[model samples]
Every structure is written in C-alpha cells, then in structure tokens.
Target: MSAERVHRTTHDVTVAAPAGVVYGLISDAVQWPLYFPPNVHVEQLEFDGERERLRMWATANGEVKSWTSRRVLDAVARRVEFRQELPARPVRSMGGTWIVEPLGADRCKLTLLHDFTVDGDDPGAVAWVERATDTNSTAELANIKALAERWANLDELVLTFEDSVRVNGPAELVYDFLHRVADWPELVPHVSRLDVVEEEPGVQVMSMDTLTADGSSHTTESVRVCFPDAGRIVYKQTATPLLMSAHTGEWTVEQDETGATVVSRHSVVLREENIERVLGEGATVAAARRYVREALGRNSTATMNLAKSHAENAVTVL
Candidate 1:
C-alpha cells in the first residue's frame, strides 16, 4: 500500500514587538479566546510547566469544532510545538509549530506551520481541512501581530470584570435558568428579543437584541458552549457592540454551604476608533473602559439577579 498523503502549509507575519512578548502571547493558550478571533475557548487540562495539554474550541469556516492538543513550550527559543491529540472530523492527524524569531530589539518574525492528513485521504476532506487550517492560521498570525505590536497599550484596550449573586436555592435550578437562554426574552427585562439555535447538543448559536439604559437596542450574535454538570457556560460574541471589537464571557454557578452563587464574567476588547463616535467627542480610552464596564456589568447583574429569583422562586413555589 502507498503511504498516506499529508498536507503541509506555513503562515508567517512580521510583528513589531519583542520575540519574548510574541512567544508569551502564543504560549498562553488559556487567554487565546480573548486575543484570537477564531478561538472560542481553551481549557488547560494538564500542565507541567513546559509541556501541557489543552482542550480547545474554535470556529472553522463558521462552524464550531473542538479538539484536544498536546503542547511543548520553549521560552528560551521562543518556540512552541503542538499536536492535536484528537483531531476533529475530516482530519486524521494535525500538528504544528510556532516559531518567533527576533529580527531586532523590538521586532520579531512569527511563523506557523501545519501538517495534517485527512480521514480516508478523500479529496473533499483534504480540501476542507486545508481551508480550515489556512483560515485559522492566517487569522491567528494576524491577531498575534496586531496584539504584539500594541503590547504597550493592551491594558487600555482589554477590559475584564465579573458580577455575581447568591441564590437561595439549588445550583441545578440556577444552571437550568442560564442554560435555557431561549426563554430570556420573557424572563429577562433587558433582553428585548432573542433567537437561539442548538444544532449540536450543548452548543448554541444565539442572536439577541438588548435594550440599553437609554432605551436603544443593539443586536449581537454569539456562540455558547454549556457544561451542565459543571454549571458553567462560556460564550464568544461574534458580533459586538459599537464600542467593542471582541467580547467573551462566562456564567458559572457554585454551590456552597448556604446556597448557590451565580457569577457572570466578561472580557472585552475596546474599539479605540469608535470611542469618540460612540461616546461623543473628547472621550478617552479610560472613559470608554468605564462606559463598557458599567454597561456590561449592569446587564450581567440584571441577569444574575433574575436567575437568582428564578431559582429561589421555583423552590418557594414547589
């Protein structure tokens, strides 16, 4: 029998940042959802400082796919190598390396290389895998370059915060309330309209219209992954508000001695160019940060409160 065919591709970018900085950004897979457009979430399953295992979820050609990866990080060499432990469908095997080469004191060359074999070595499967790898690799490289170049201002551009409430009831009810987001339009006051599609179990694609404090409405679309047993739901907003370039969040329910605590966490990247237009003239990044924090916190707090009520009232009624 002939050897199986393997496809190889490489994508590279020049980043106006230190090699160490670029390496740090690529090594920390947990924060990828915040920085990379294609990545939705990453869970670090195992880590031993230099070697790690990760469970990652990402969008490929508009569809969400998940896989487990084993990574080896070499900080001194500014390189990272990864192989998919369980490649998603259409892919038989996938592995890649990231190399960050220092060009100057404050410049680096970032390169991504991928090699993969398709299931059955079918032409259609090979093409699909090629497109996905190309799309995701290009996006990842571009995002790394953009963020690395702006490392100095990352603090001003990225915002993260959380809101929580104590529910005087079972964690299951609270999780149920969060998981059934399709009912948010009637149950949540700020959610004026919502459409949810769940083609795959535990994965949701939602389009929602939310009313602001000023009575205006804005629409957003998101992909959400739910973990019922863990009482956690993580989501990335593919479509964001005027002031945000990217947004990702999580809802978690924790059970304690007294009752359950529900928390909502939000991480947002500001659109600096839209700040003046959205918040009026002379608005600084700080102002935009505060505005976004307040707006998102307010909505999250509302949702948390309602979830608490739903859980508590359900217990009371029963």
Candidate 2:
C-alpha cells in the first residue's frame, strides 16, 4: 500500500507577556472554549502530571467536530506537544506543538505547529483539512496575543459563577427541559425568541434572543454538546452581547437522596471597551461586572425555577 501524504503548517504571533503566561494559556485545554473562538468544549479524560488526555469539540469549516488527543506539557521549556488519538473525519492523523520563546521580561513569541494526513489522501479532503487548520490556528494565535497582552487586567476581565436549585423530581425531566431549548420562548418569560438545530445527535446549534430588565433584547448564537447519561450540557456562545467578549456555560443535574439538584454555571470575559457604551457614561468595570452577574443570574435562576416546576409537576401528574 502507498504511504499517505502528510501536510505541515506553522503559525505564530508575538505576545506582550511573559513566556510563562503564554505557556499557561496553551497548557490549559479545559479553558480553550473561553479563550479560543473555534473551541466549543474540552473534557480532560486523564492526567498524570506532565501528560494528559483530552476530548475536544470545535468547529472546522463551520462544522462541529469532536476528537480525542494526548498532550505532553513542559513548563520549563514552555512547550506542549499534542497528538490526536482519534482524529475526526477527513483527518487520519494529526499532531501539533506549541512553543513559547521568551523575547524579554514581558514579551514572548508564541508559535503553533501542525502536521496531519488525510484519511485517503484525497485532494478534496486534504484541501478541507488545510483550510480548517489554517483558519483555527490563525484565530487561536490572535486570541492568545490579545489575552496575553492584557495580562494585568485578566482578573477583572474574566468571571465565573454558578446558580443552582433543588428539585423534587427526576433528573431526566430537568435535563429534558434544558435540552429542548426551542421551547424556551414559550416556557421561559425572559427568552423572547430561540431557534435550535441538531445536525448531529447531541450537538445543537442555536440562536436566542433574550430580554433584559429594561425591555431591551440581545441575540446570541451558541453551540451546545449534551451528555444524556451524565445529565450535563456544555455550551459556548459564538456570538455574544456587547458587554461580553466571550461566554461559556454548563447545565448539570445530579440525583440525590431527596430528588435532584440542577445547576447552571457561567463564565464570561468582559469587553472592557463596551462597558460604558452599554451601561452608561460613568460605568466602571466593577459596575459592569455587577450588572452582568445580576442579569445572567436572574435569567439562569428563572430557567432553573421553571425546570424545577416542570419536573415537579410531571411527578405530581404521574
């Protein structure tokens, strides 16, 4: 049999931050959805100090794809090497390395390298892989540069919080309520409009319009991955509100002695430049943070309450 053709590419950017900071960003795969635009979700399958396994979901040429990867991390050298254990379609094998070279005390060069082979070395498949790799690598590098440059304010720029409710019914019902988001417009008061499509089972692409306290609305598009057996759903917003640069969230339901507990978790990266434009002339980052926290908490809490009612009512009817 003939050997498959291999293609290689390299992408890099200069970051205005320390090599350690840049390396930290690349080493944490679980936080990719929050930092990188194309990533939808990442699950850590296993880790033993320097080596780890990850299951990742991301968009390739506007299509959602999932794969598992093994990665080796070297903090001292500021390098991470990764190989896809189970590459997605059109990709037979894929591997990459991230190298962070220190330029100065607060400057570094971040480089990403990729080498991959297509399933059958088909021209069309090779082209697709090339385009996807180029697009994703460009976006990832840009994101790292932007975030690393603002290392001083990252604490104020990034936020994470969650809200939960106790439900006196089955966990499945709660999962059902959240999974069927298309019905949210009718079931949830704050949701003005919602459209969802699932081209692949358990993977949803949705656009939603939600109302604020002042009667204004904002639209967001998101990709969601559902785990039925685990009673969890994870999502990342591709389109965000004016005040947010990025948003990712999770919905979880766990059964307990009494019934179940439903939780909604949210992580957001604030758009500092738009804070005053969105909230008024004198709005500060703290004010923006408070406003966002209240607004998201209210919406998630409302949904959780309704989900609780839906499950409890179903139990009552049965």
Candidate 3:
C-alpha cells in the first residue's frame, strides 16, 4: 500500500487475456464503463496527447454523484492512476491504481489499489463511501478480469488456410516484391489500408490498420525488410492497441534447387508487456513462447500461404 494516509483499499484479480490486450482495454478510459457496472460513466474534458482530465458519474442510493478526475498513465510500468478533483461531496479526495502481472503464458494477475480521504466536514459519510468503494472495487476487478479472459479465448476463433506455388523468377525478385510492403493492399483482400510512415536505410516502419475477418479494425505499427541472400523478408509489429511496448516476429525464405522458394514465417517473441498482462506470475520466457505458438500458429500458416501466392504470381508476371 502507498504510504499516503488517505482511505486505502486494494483488490486483485486474474484475467486470461494477453497483458497487452487487458492493458489496452483499461487504458482506454472512454471504454471503462463498457465492462464495469451500469452506474459508471467516463467523460473527457481535455486531453493533451498524454494525460486526460475527465469526469465520472455514478448513482449512489438513487442520488446522482459526480466527480472530476485526472487520469495519468505510466506506460513502462503498465499502471493507470486516477486522482479526484471536483464535485467534492463529503469525499474530499480520491485516487486508485491498476497493476498487471504475468501469471502464465495465457493468464495474468491484476491488482487495484484505491486510496481516498473523507472530507473533515463529513467523516461518517466518507466512511460509508469507503465501505461501498471497497465492495464495488472487488466486483469491478472481477468483472475486468472476466472481460480480458473472454478475449484471450479468441485463440480458438482463429482459422488458417495454407498453400504454396512455385515462382519461376529469382528468389531476389520474389523477395523484393515482398519487400515493397506498401503494395500489400493491392494484393491482400482484407487489407484495405497501408500507410508507410518511415523508410530508412535498412528498415521500414509503417502504420497498419487492418479489418479483421469479422469486419473489426485493429491498428498497429509494423516494420519489414528483405534479405535477398537468404531469400527471406520479415515483418514485425512494433506497437500495440494500448501499451507502448513492441511486439514482433520474422519470416524466412529458402529457395529449393528447382528454383521454387519455401517461405515460412517463424513466430518469434511475444511482447513482454503482453506476457505480463496475460500471465501475471509464474510465467517464463519458454512458457510464453509455447502459449504464443499454440494461440497464433494457425495464423502463421495462413500468412505464409498469402506470401506464397504473391511471390508465385509476381514471378510469373516477371
């Protein structure tokens, strides 16, 4: 517990979602009430691309109570803290923090600490508020855990299809075509937008917002490069939905004696932040790799097939 003398309460819960996913949902303050109880509402009054000044509304005993708060983010720590400011109704001050830790490859533990002080004018009322907050805090933590776990189960929803065709051109030509990642939208169906932001000497960092098979959109940062000598090009995600950390992997290509290439993407590392959020404690690097493989192997197969088709077709045209 923090050393502050404010009324303090702490609660912990475990969620099944990848830590990155859980952190995203919680950090998106606008989306807080989506999983919490109906009594809560979040409104943003000002945002400076860093922190947000917001207001929360709730119904207590059929009475409408509101408070203004500032939400601060500690990206490296994966914690969110909120401090109260306005509408001081007997509750002079308040604040709480949410913490996430890795449990296993597929599970994460979350802890929430709340510290508050009752107004001197109404100590009894403040005590009552503290009790209610304590109980509700537990319930809210449980609900958030449930929400994250549900998303983690999406590993079951992934479907994969894989096939390859031989391209007659040099592996370099095929690799180069793959290297021009800016052309992905012209080749992939579901990929509707591709924005290349930076193309430096050896690396290309681009913004990718793709629509899922279910028509939902996910935006992230990606980088790519080609190793012609190795007959391979690798693509990796550099950003996530919520956390500032990076998540990425690579693809390798090997040319057969017959001039055809056997290209496959090897799932590399899971994002550390993701590992912390999904598996809070008792999780090791090996365990995270296994979990990521089990959850994302199918997608890797499908991606390989896509690359195979593109390479073969481009070779034929050349």
Best by lDDT: 2
The digit string of per-residue lDDT tens for model 2 on 123-223 reads 99999999999999999999999999998999999999999999999999999999999899999999999999999999999999999999999999999
**Model 3, span 115-222: residue lDDT tens:** 777656356776677766866677678767766666744333222222244555456555665666688778655567788743234446678766654576778765
Candidate 1 C-alpha lDDT tens digits along 1-318: 445598999999999999989999999999999889999999999999999999999999889899999999999898999999998998889999999999999998999999999866899988888898889999889888888888999888999999889889999999998999999999999999999999899999999999999999999999999999899999999889889988999999999988999999999999888999999999999999999999999999998888888889888543
The TM-scores of all predictions, comma-separated, are 0.97, 0.98, 0.45
Displacement of residue 204 (Cα, Å) in model 1 is 1.0
Most accurate candidate by TM-score: 2
lDDT of candidate 1? 0.92
Segments in model 3 whose C-alpha atoms lie over 4 Å from true places: 1-5, 121-123, 152-318
Cα misplacement distance, residue 185 of candidate 3 (Å)? 52
What's the CA error at residue 13 for candidate 1, in Å? 0.6
Candidate 1: residue 5 Cα off by (Å)? 0.7
C-alpha RMSD by candidate, in order = 1.3, 1.1, 16.6
Q: Once superposed on the true structure, which residue ranges of model 1 sit more than 4 Å away at CA?
A: 1-3
lDDT values of the candidates?
Answer: 0.92, 0.96, 0.60
Alpha carbon lDDT at 190, candidate 1: 96
